[model samples]
Target: MNRRKSREIAMKLLFEISINTNDVSETIENYKENNENFDDVDFAYVENILDGVAKNNEFLNKTIEGNLTNWKLSRISKVNMSILKIAVYEICFQEDIPSKVSANEAVNLAKKYSDDKSPSFINGVIGNIIKLK
Candidate 1:
């Protein structure tokens, strides 16, 4: 499974949802409409993660809040926040994918989308969550 591609889609969908509070299914449908050849494998990942995160948002936010040191989830950048949500979802909910993979992918997303410091900041937060777990 090309989880990185899936993770990328998950993050994109999650970020979009965070912004406008659109329906996940609708947003995904729109996403699919735009991106050609997104394929079933990738779409499944996007749908699963988008659904998973939405299903447990309150709990996931609380878990992320608990792991944050002197910082609230809202304080983080939207880009990093989106990445963190994906990572934390994988960490706290999805057991098929390892925590380390989630953490690494989050850092990569941060490096790709967020400011320079986001990678380390995200790494630290994810590391703390791993330690706590």
Candidate 2:
């Protein structure tokens, strides 16, 4: 599958876990049962992202919460928030990914999965973060 498609699946799984407050194992099992097309690498990426987010949630949330304007982290859509978290994690910890790529991918994910305002909002916040970092 394409990278964007992989990211979308990863984001969706992350959001579902966030909304449902489900464990990673359960989520992975559910995905395995539900998505016939999922492969090992795709599962690996999703697991890595989810684990990274969980491991660094406090720092990630604080970073994201700081960048957002007139909005609290809790107030963001689950989809948008998940997208941001994964991208921000990539920016902060995944040195292999360029910060610009992470930010752009995040904005695209926001546009694809969130409201009309979400893409720009994501871009602005991520831009601010890249600048500050």
Candidate 3:
């Protein structure tokens, strides 16, 4: 199902949605149009991640905020938040995927899309969640 691709698309969409609350549907449509190769599975994954995050944002943030070792949710960059939200959503709700896989994917995304320190920070936060469980 190309989970990595799905995670990337989910992160991108979440970044946009977090910045601009309105026009998320339009944005998703535009993303689909740009990535014509995205099959139904990819589309569904992206949609589910976005929908899940949106529906449980408060809970997700609370989970994330509690897991932070030396940071606050407010201080986290939007890019990191996007990655963390997806990983956290999967860890807490999407029982099919292993927590380690979700966490590693999130760390990879943070490394690619955020600062040098982001990968470790993301890994640590996701790891903390796993420990809490």
Report the lDDT tens digits of candidate 2 across residue range 1-133: 3566667778988999988989877888898887686553466677788889889999999999999889988788888889999999999998988999999999989888899999999999999999999
**lDDT (Cα) of model 1:** 0.86
Q: Model 1 — which ten-residue stretch has the worst lDDT?
A: 36-45
lDDT score at residue 10, model 1, on the 0-100 scale:
83
User: What lDDT does candidate 1 reach at residue 1?
Assistant: 65
Taking the tens digit of each residue's C-alpha lDDT, what string does model 1 give over 92-122? Answer: 8889989999999999999998899899999
What is the lDDT, from 0 to 100, of the residue 118 in candidate 1? 92
The lDDT values for all models are 0.86, 0.86, 0.89
Backbone clashes in each candidate structure, one number apiece? 0, 0, 0
lDDT of 3 by residue, 1-133 (tens): 7879878988998999888874557779987777667663476778888999999999999999998977878999999999999999999999999999999999999889999999999998999999998
Q: In model 1, which regions exceed 4 Å deviation? A: 39-41
Residue 42 error for model 3, in Å?
Answer: 1.2
lDDT of model 3 at residue 12? 91
Candidate 1 TM-score over all chains jointly: 0.93
Ranking the candidates on lDDT from highest down gives 3, 2, 1
- Better TM-score candidate (2, 3): 3
